[model samples]
Target: MTDHETNETAAEVKVDRQRPETPSYEEVLFYERKPAGFWVRFWAYLIDLLVVTALTSILVKPVFALVGLETSGVPWYAPYAILSALIFYGYFVLMTKFFRQTVGKMIMGIRVVSLKTDDLSWMTLLFREWIGRFISVTIWPLYWIVGFTPLKQGVHDYIADTTVVHEESFRKNKLLQKKTPDGSGLHETSAF
Candidate 1:
């Protein structure tokens, strides 16, 4: 082959390699990813609160005791309270950042996903877990908005452009089938 021909063939092959395989009409399926409801999320958050309380009692209480710090009757801005707040925010931030779910969320079979990006970023985590959570915690009723929203998103979710969804809810089932030339069934599957 001529050099020009060979280069053209190589370019064609590269373009083909970059192109995605388009599924035929027979392979198309419709399925919706169910957003976590308020009750489930409430339970998950309750579990996380229990975990945070336990962690604070086990980890923070000891340090305060050892340092002769009085935790009782102290103001909210006290050193112990500040450390506890740090732990609270840190737990949510780190867990969501690393696993996309906290221990409670894992138990509840729910996970946080970003609507805007494929992967969660630090800024997203900070906004969702820290600042957003602080607001939710303060207002308390803002968490209830999850149930009312079309996508079942909480205030924090709205702020960070994230949503909680049931884990691995998508499954390949025979939602629709087509007959092949040999009378075999062609199954349709759902995609996330």
Candidate 2:
């Protein structure tokens, strides 16, 4: 071999030895295949709808009252439906982005995750929770296809390259399970 090629190979070996190897998220989730099935995801969505409905009613009342819409003095052009839509989108996007699961999903022990990664990203959450959902809602059958999919992913999930998984099942997977610094099985959440 040429002298330059020999030196480059030796340098690569030295770099590999000096650098500490960290596992990629894909590697961690490889053995974790327990995606949330139809019933569980459906129940979680139902619970989330109830929660959002309650919260929207409570929040909308004050805003509507301020704009005189609650008591029937509002302008004809007032966008009440748009406001509601925004609230719904915000609730799902923000909650899933920060907590990995909405209140309903938490109750059902399910969480949204990227198909190829361990942590969820903001863009992925937006597409998954908003754009994908909008399409699913407009085309209802697309959402129902989750029941027959191997990974239990609906059209929305496929669009976002995401999947909903049973959080407990994921944590229980021996290959993916990780212990806290304190030896607890639970993941650490920041206190803020």
Return the top candidate by TM-score: 1
**Candidate 1 lDDT, 25-114, residue by residue in tens:** 354556656789999999999999999999999999999999999978889999999989999999999999999999999999999999
**Model 1: per-residue Cα lDDT at residue 147:** 90
Query: Any residue pairs clashing in model 2, and if so which?
Result: none
For every model shown, the clashing-pair count is 0, 0
Task: Name the candidate that leads on lDDT.
Answer: 1
* Candidate 2 per-residue C-alpha lDDT over 27-132 given as tens digits, one digit per residue, 9 for 90 to 100: 1323464889888988988898998888778988678777767524445355766676787889899999889889999999998888778788887887888889
The true-versus-predicted C-alpha distance at residue 130 of model 1, in Å, is 1.1
Instruction: Estimate the TM-score of every prediction.
Output: 0.73, 0.66
Cα RMSD, each candidate: 13.8, 13.5
